[model samples]
Target: MSACNAIASPVLDPKGPIAAAQTQLLLDAVAIMMIVIVPVFIMAALFTWRYRGTNRNARYAPNLAYYWPVEILIWGVPAGIIFWLGLHLWSATHRLDPYKPIDPEVPPLRVEAVAQDWKWLFIYPEQDIAVVNELVFPAGRPLALRITSDTVMNSFMIPGLGGQIYAMAGMQTRLHLLADEPGEFWGRNVQYSGRGFADQQFRAIATTTEGEFGAWVEKVKASTQMLDATTYEQLAKPSVKVPVTYYSGVQPGLFDSIIAKWHGDGNHLHAQVTGTEQAR
Candidate 1:
């Protein structure tokens, strides 16, 4: 997509609540920085013309040194801007924390993500189904992702939904996102792993229509393919630009086993954190 176009930037054209807030923050940052940038550029032009050697009428103050007003304008203004920006950043960091649930009252849809060499595996535990390079969830609900890498480290991001989290072998990362309505948002691995990294992408579908999510799940369940240990072994092999695949069944505890395979202790820390969140 042409990011330079007004509507081409996924970040700027947010379809989710978190992305919308991030967009606002970006615009605000630009406006605040322009407070100094615009005037500085304009003053630079005026100063260059006024102090030119050809301009004899211009006042030449060779010995005139410091002006407290100008010093305050440059130093104090930036200081204030930095202080304000810092506060905003601090608040946002906590407010948009990926671990925190969007609405504590609403139960989040859990999706386990496994990052491989050149593709993504999304497993819906509650639904007992899995898909390759496609993530589907009900819209207007919070999505809680448990992500890890089976190969090299990778970064997961959905620009239109905001936030970026890394997936590392033997470690699980958390990210919570919510879509405001039905739409297909782009999801990809931003980290560079190999030649196939360019094709490490997926489609995130948010279903707004009633029964849509259920119908999609049913469709996946109707697929003949099954995800067993042997099946997963072959599926994990490195490949590029893999077409979407659906599995009617998933081996129980498959997600945990993948973590244990890499990290001897398993995702004990993440499990503990998840337990604590549930209690609250």
Candidate 2:
């Protein structure tokens, strides 16, 4: 369902160096673009006032000559802007590449994510754990996510953290994010995936310590539902505004099996179970 929480806002917080750099880049670009845009408007206003019909002394030269320096000033400025933009673009791309590892002293926490019909499935492979509707990570630590999709393409995004990465069947995309503070952030599917697109959302809880994360994982593992193949089939079906759920134990490599089937590749043949749940 739509996860709109008013408690914490990630965009307003600059927890790490990358986030701060990104914010500065945005501000600088806006300032640079406005240089030409503002002056053009002022010149247009001045020309309109000075060239009014009543002023007979105003030169009405219909044949205007083109000045090379003025042409260069107009064209070269934009070209320089484009070059500046390209440099920043390349720097950010290399820095944010999902596969690229973070600093050795502060490596990103690994997270495997799967985007399904109308929900998200997050698995912490190191912990041998899974959560159906919620995801958690430690603050001030880099997060490396291995993301993929089930039926259609979806995007994994947390604006407070960083850019959105696509989750498509048969392929894996990487995303790196970090939060400096302990708070709950919002994550959602930015792209339409199907019937319940609008309701596809989840909670991204950023905790302070490993102990707290371990405790939360233990609580999730203590849930009553068994997340076997059958249970997953029901849970994966299209459902709108479904409440958050946790499964005690999940079948190993269930996400891989789904990806295999979706790609039509003969990786592993898992039985497909159909359900009558209404598509949202």
Candidate 1 per-residue lDDT over residues 64-164, each given as its tens digit: 79989989998999999999899998898899888888898999899999999799999999999999999999898899999999999999998888778
lDDT of 2 by residue, 12-78 (tens): 4555555666777777778788878998999999999899888888887788798799899999988
RMSD in angstroms, all models? Answer: 5.5, 5.3
Report the number of the highest-TM-score candidate: 1
Taking all chains together, the TM-score of candidate 1 against the true structure is 0.90
Candidate maximizing lDDT? 1
What TM-score against the true fold does each predicted structure earn? 0.90, 0.87
Q: Name the 10 consecutive residues with the lowest summed lDDT in model 2.
A: 271-280
Candidate 1 deviant stretches above 4 angstroms = 1-9, 265-280
lDDT of 2 at 191: 98
